[model samples]
Target chain A: MLDVFADYMTYQVFEITKGSKLGDAVNFFIYDSLKIFIMLAIIIFFVSIIRTYFPPERTKQLLSHKREFLGNILAALLGIVTPFCSCSAVPVFIGFVESGVPLGVTFSFLISSPMVNEVALVLLWGMFGWKIAMIYISTGVLVAIISGYIIGKFKLEHLVEEYVYQMKVGQNEIESMTVAARLQYAKDYTKEILRKVWLYVVIAISLGGFIHGYAPQDFLADYAGKDNLFAVPLAVLVGVPLYSNAAGVIPIVYALMEKGMSMGTVLAFMMSVTALSLPEMIILRNVLKPKLIAIFVSILVVAITLTGYMFNIVL
Target chain B: MMKIEILGMGCQKCSTLLETTKQAAEELGINAEFVKVENIKEIMKYGVMSTPALVVDGVVKVSGKVPNKEEIKALLNS
Candidate 1:
């Protein structure tokens, strides 16, 4: 139905020639925008409802006292449902720590929360197939787990700011909502996220359409193609400093992939952009010492770089 | 007299909650003392991990979201 509408708009309403590049790009833009918006709304709404069940307070209770490897895994999984923002990281970190949740486990939750979120998953599914989306999610969770476990093993407790340990966190009652309230919260949350991301989505899709219509075939293949040993690391390096939401970056990912960038390299780039952001690191610096922060970034960079290479070889 | 505390580290939602809560207080004609809790330690004392949280008379009424005016009014009345 959407395809038919896109075709009608492009050919009948706009009157660009049926097979012209402009018509093709316009058609691609319209179809993709409609499809992505629909997917984002439905997924975000359901995810928000799920989130209402897993606030950071409850997540802390779940993670506290669990052993390291298992805790890392659980934390990474919970990170997907837990409602966390970088701005609140300090309090969450302190809360988790004071409640006896291991540092590594806390790190796992932090890493996966931003990286393997519903928005990124939905966007990847919309653009790429489910197979690629699954690959992105699994690898993202693995990186979070492995990096957090390694940090945990290092026993970098002293590296945390002294105040984080000294501070006592009070326990408050978790809010309970009725079914109607949950539904309302979900509705409001979906609207809030869509309002925040729609502009980025439109801009990304437009840029992708332009690239699809105009960029030369195999333009990026020579430099960042599968054969390039350095391509994965290079993509991660570039992506880490360049901060953008998943919505803002997916169109560029589409453009790059269309230009023959390898799947692994592209996925790595997206993960770096979302997961290991500089601003998030800055926020974390409030509690983590400079050394701990450096170690955290380096571990993730290496892990992501490896994941990129593994994907390049496997798929 | 009621004391209402908005707990957050100065994020946009924190301010939004503050404004809505203030408006609700006026609408309900309740004499309330409003405190904006920006200190992380002070916020932690309330045991609220997420913000902006609404504290009515030292008890947490809500956290992690900006409730609407009607909801805030309900919280105030309660």
Candidate 2:
């Protein structure tokens, strides 16, 4: 009976240790997790410097008081430089309105905030290549500009909050500080920001790492990565409802590439998740009514899908 | 204690920074009262050009990017 029990225990151990997936997951958690973490650290440092240079109010002022298309174009341009998302959203929205910037123009700024972040761009360059990074950045800027202009042309002024019109542009609260004060401020805020989302980045990157290291190549090529006619549109559709951001998504993109997912398909998905997340939509509801939000989401979906297809064709 | 704020408009990256920073702190044996500064005005107050910033003891250590647990640990330890 004792001999029988030992045999059963050994069999159980063998079963647990035999699968390749378990080893993959373990190795991934160990090796890939570290790489993802390091990348995130670098991004955090870059973001810190940006926080020190551009404040939301400053960006808002730049985008305020311009022709709709011009302002939207400017906002998209500024969005590339400026940091922060929802925080900038309402403030920029209010600032633009107070300065008579067009609604569509402001939307451009809003759209680009999440999609074309600086850190994500850098990581993409390192992970994929500069060509792809430039492509992503240009396309992101283009989306912001075009979408903003389209909404501006419609003169969707009525969609803005009444309070926004009445709101005055407040002077930046931290302007009087010395250099030391400014540096201190940046460091403090960087820590705060890092505190919130580092884990998710790690988790997402771990998944990415796993994919990078272990996902099957031919399976991916045949399915998600292919230049199939439906691939781009399908990727967009799949990406839309998901809520992972670029930071989390990029590492995964590396994995996807290994798994045979096309760069274009992954990008479409990342764009949707970063720019049009469900949470962002929910927050927007506070400032924008459901109708406006729905329109925005719809437009983004189409734009992202088109972008994906275009990329696959061009690349 | 470290002061941390994530600047991105509440995206997953921002959220990831929060969790990873804490993990870093714990791994390095430090205590921090982390703050999430979601207000763009507040982010601008610190002059953060990027969302999701990391501040240690009132210093802007990282911004616009997420850090891994070990990196966070190093920041705390250093």
Candidate 3:
């Protein structure tokens, strides 16, 4: 229904404007904006409700003292629904540790929370179709699990700030919420998220529209082609410092893909941008020592790079 | 009058706890003060590990999970 509406509007505009540059830009913008916004609203609403079930407090309880492999998987999965903000990094870390959640399992949650979030999934699904979205989700979760397991193997718990280990928060009471309250929570969450990123979505879609209408078709393909060995790593490196959620970065991703940037490279870039950003790292630094942070970054970088190469090789 | 502190980051659970606690207090017709402690340092001071914790009169009552209104009422009375 949405696609048909978008297509009809674009078609009408193209005819009315005689297929001019303005027409093309307007068409691209209208189609992308309508599709993305609708998708965001619907997906975020459902995901928000799901999130109400898996708050950090609950996730900490589930993953605490869980065995290594199962813990990594569960943590990564929980990371999907757990609502985590950078500012809460310190307390959540302390909370998880005090509750016996392993450092590596916590890392899995942290990595996947940003990297494979609902926002990223919905945007990818809306713009790129489900095939690429599925691939991104699977690979993202896999990377989180593997990286966390690797970190766990190293037994780097001691590398956490000494203060985290020493601080103990005794168990507290768990609250049961009514369905109405849960719905209200979901409503508020969706509003908060949409309010934060609405402008970014508009800007991103507008840029995407401009690129779709005007940019040369072969720019990225010729330069950052799949055959280029350095393309994947370079994209990841560039993406790390540039902080943006999947929704905010979708316009660039769309433009790049249109320009023939390989899926592997784009996915790698997206992972690096969401999961390995500098600001998130600094926030985590309050809980993790420098050495542990370095290890985390290196593992993620290597894992994401490998994912990129695998995609380039296979698809 | 009673003092109630909801300790957690401003996540959904914390907000639920806040509302639930408020409702519990209102149903019981108890005059109470509700405070949301978002600062990590202050929350840690209470030795509350998980988020969405409840503190009554500066005593840690619950640490994690969003308890229902009935539980809140019991906690409030106790």
Candidate 4:
């Protein structure tokens, strides 16, 4: 279905330019935009439906009584399905902590929820193939678990606000949802995500289209190639300030890869953009002290940078 | 006469609870005073950290999740 649309778009664009470079760019833009938007809508709808089952209440229950390493693993995995709204992060953090979910376990969920979410998976799978998608999810979860475990070892419970401990919230009740309500929530969630991301997707894809048509393949490789040891960290630094969803970022990744950027550098950049963005830090700062937030960001940067270097070496 | 207070910072779930509570009250044919507590300080005064809490009169009946409409109806009736 999409292939036909892409071909037709390409034909239309090429007809005007008679196979010129501008035609190629326009063709690439149309094909990519159509393919990505369709995939994003379908995947986000289905994923939102699945998300209805894994709200913060349910996630708190799942991690409330589990042991450390096991809890971290479970939390990280659960984070993938659970829909995370940053506005609720504070309340959920308090809820989890009050319910006896170890602070570290909560961190794992917090980390993975945004980083290893279905949005990232759908975008990566659509553009980069299943292998990269699978790798990204696994590695993201692994980082979450490991970071949570390490934070657990540090006994940073003191870093959380003192009010959280004193806040005497009652035992939360998880209510069953009707099928209609679930579908409504799914539809709303899909619309919300699409609305927030559509403009970014268009811009990213257009930039990618331009790059694919005009830039020399060796341009980025000369500076950010695997041979450059600093490339991974630099990518992480550059990505942190750019607040974008996976759908928005994947176009850049696609363009970079086509221009000979290493898989490791690209993956590192993607993780940094999604996980360590400045906005996320500001949101989390409401519940966490500056010291703890610093530790969290440092750990994520280190983990992502290491992952990038390792992948570059191996692949 | 009954007072239904829904506590939260007015996120999506809180709005849903508000709607559900209104529907339940209407179906039960009860003239109830419904209040939405959106201020974080006000919510904290209830000793509830988790959002979308339902308070019946002065007592908190539910916290941290949206109760189904049937459950809300039951709470209203009780």
Candidate 5:
């Protein structure tokens, strides 16, 4: 049905030739925009409802005092369901620490929460096939667990700021809600997320449409192709400094993949941009010492780069 | 008289919560003292991991989201 509408809008309403580049771009944009918005609305609403059940406070309680490896695994998995925002990172970090959640476990949650988010998953599944999406999810969680475990093994607790250890966090009751309230919250949260991301999604898809129509085939293959050894690391390096939500980045990833950028390199780039950003580094610096931050970044960069290379070889 | 404390680390939602809570208090004709707790240490003292938490008379009423005006009014009344 959407394909028909896009065909009609491109061929009949616009009067562009059926096989023209402009027609192709416009058709791609219209179809993708409609499909993405629908997917985003439904996915975000359900994800928001699930989020209400796993507040950070409850997650803190669950993970506190667990052994390191198991805690890291649980934290990484729970990171997907827990509601988190960078703005709340400090309080959450402190809360985790004060509550005796292992630093490594906390890092696992931090790493996976932003990297394996619903928006990224939805966008990847929509743009790419479910197989690729599943690959991204599994690899993302693996990176989080391994990187966090490595950090824990390093025993870098002393690298945290002194104040984070000294701070005494009081306990507050989790807010309870009725079914109607949960539904309402989901509705409101979905609207809020859509309002925030719709513009970025449109802009990204527009750029993607342009690339899809105009960019010559195999343009990026030579530079960032599967055989290029530096491609994955370079992509991660470039992605870390730039901050963008998954909605804004996935369209570009689609365009890049279409233009012959290797799948692993593009995926790594997307993960780097979403998971390890300069602004988040600055925010984390408040709690983590410079040395710890550097180590964390290095570990993630290595882990993401390895995942990229692994995908390149396997897929 | 009521004391309403908005706990956050100065994020956008924190200010929005403050504005909505103040409006709710005014609509209810309740004399309220509003405090914006922006310090991380201060916010941690409340034990709320998520921000934009509403506290009435030092009791945490809500955390992690900005309730609508009607919801805020209900909270204030309660």
Candidate 6:
């Protein structure tokens, strides 16, 4: 029986390799690389445009002594206009406090920046069409706002430094430059991010391309197919360690779904890959206390897993 | 010239605040130097436990949060 299985595996490998030349593989890699670059470039471009035209500093004016709920809503909107990554979220987090922005409101901003971002949206659209992308973005923003409001309602503002409320930083640090200069700033910013994250993109896309080309459709169908309830959380778990995020992972999700993986599992995997990545966690440990960081991660796990289950049932 | 120090481990918010401060300073005609402080030992020197702390001139004015451009400007001017 083992010999039979081995023979079958050999045959499968041979079948996959047959008629597929090195040129074809190279072409596939190049095609996929362009797709990755285009999607990422669009996101980077959008982020730069927003940074140049409407800085997050402007949003500080909105949360000026507003009600917590309203402040959270505005914060989410601000996160939409200002595209910051998890790494840069801290300085602006400081800026919000020094500007008198409320704590609950700040949470909304934090959630929106990482959860519903340009990179995620464009990649989702590239892989799964605009409709799904729109749904994903809208839902993501909503989650940020609602979670912030909930946290605000609990009056967790005291968790912040007392000095934050009384303090002030000047407005001299606002946007100031000509169109050409701003453009340069944006371009340079995009290139910097690209340089940092291109490796992840390449890894994600290359793996996805190979899976697209040769993964066994029947096995994937039997295991991760639409009917398998276990696949959702399993996918989520498998995805968390990969750390590529929504932009890098969505293409793989799309390709896999096309080859018969369930949408719910794929989406859960995507969310896990983006929201609960190991690198994000490593980066997070610098600012957040272990308990608080653990809480944050737990919230994400519950929320994303639940989301996956719901999708499993509905879609 | 005003000197501003931003303390954080290079999170998105810290970087944005730094960018926003630079922009505000340019727009407001304030001459300044902006520096990012990522080392924990250095940040702790200012008694900052949380990240993205801000120091204007030599005094630690903002720690653990992003300050508005205006407020940063005011700190610089003051």
Judging by DockQ against the true structure, name the best candidate.
5
Stronger candidate by TM-score (5 vs 6): 5
lDDT of 2 by residue, A1-315 (tens): 443433344345444353367644554454444554455567666665665566665665666677667787778877775765554455445555566666787789888877887666766765567798889989998988887787777666677556556554434333444778566656765566556556655665555545544545556788776558777777777776677656666655666666777878888877877787776677666567687887888888888888888888788
Give me candidate 4's TM-score against the actual structure: 0.79
TM-score, predicted candidate 6 vs. hidden true structure: 0.66
TM-score of the A-chain for all models: 0.95, 0.77, 0.92, 0.90, 0.93, 0.73
Cα lDDT of all candidates, in order?
0.90, 0.67, 0.83, 0.82, 0.89, 0.66
Tens digits of per-residue lDDT for model 5 on A1-315? 999999999999999999887898899999988998999899999988998888899999999999998999999999887887888888889999999999999999999988897888777877787788889988898888999999999999999999998998887877687999889989998898889888878877787767654768899999989999999999999999888777778667877898899999999999899888888889899899999999999999999999999989998
Cα lDDT of model 1 by residue, A130-165, tens digit: 899888888899999999999999999999999988
DockQ of each model vs. true complex: 0.76, 0.10, 0.24, 0.21, 0.85, 0.10
Candidate 1 residue-wise lDDT, B4-66, digit = tens: 999998888999999999999999999999999999889999898888889999898998889
Candidate 1 lDDT score at position B60: 88
Task: Return the top candidate by lDDT.
Answer: 1
Residues B1-78, candidate 3: write the lDDT tens digits: 789999986767799899999999999999999899987767887756557778999888775567779988998998
Which ranges in model 2 have alpha carbons more than 4 Å from their true place?
A: A1-47, A161-163, A166-174, A189-215, B1-78
Give lDDT: candidate 3, residue A86: 60
In the range B5-62, model 6's lDDT, one tens digit per residue, is 8877766778888898888789889888888888654554454434566787767776
Q: For model 4, how does the per-residue alpha-carbon lDDT over A106-133 read when each residue is reduced to its tens digit?
A: 9888888878887788677766788999
Q: Candidate 5 chain B: minimum summed lDDT over ten consecutive residues — where?
A: B43-52
Clashes per candidate, residues 3 or more apart or on different chains: 0, 56, 13, 0, 0, 43
Query: What does candidate 3's lDDT look like per residue over A1-315, in tens digits?
Result: 765665677677445463677766766777777887888888899998988787677888899999998999999998888876665667778888888998889889889988898888877887778898999999999999999999999999888888777775655455677899789878877887888777877877776666654777878887788989999999998988787777777767877888889989998998999887787787778778899999998898899999999999999
Per-model TM-score versus the true fold: 0.93, 0.66, 0.81, 0.79, 0.93, 0.66
DockQ-superior candidate, 4 or 6: 4
Model 3 chain A: worst 10 consecutive residues (lDDT sum): A10-19
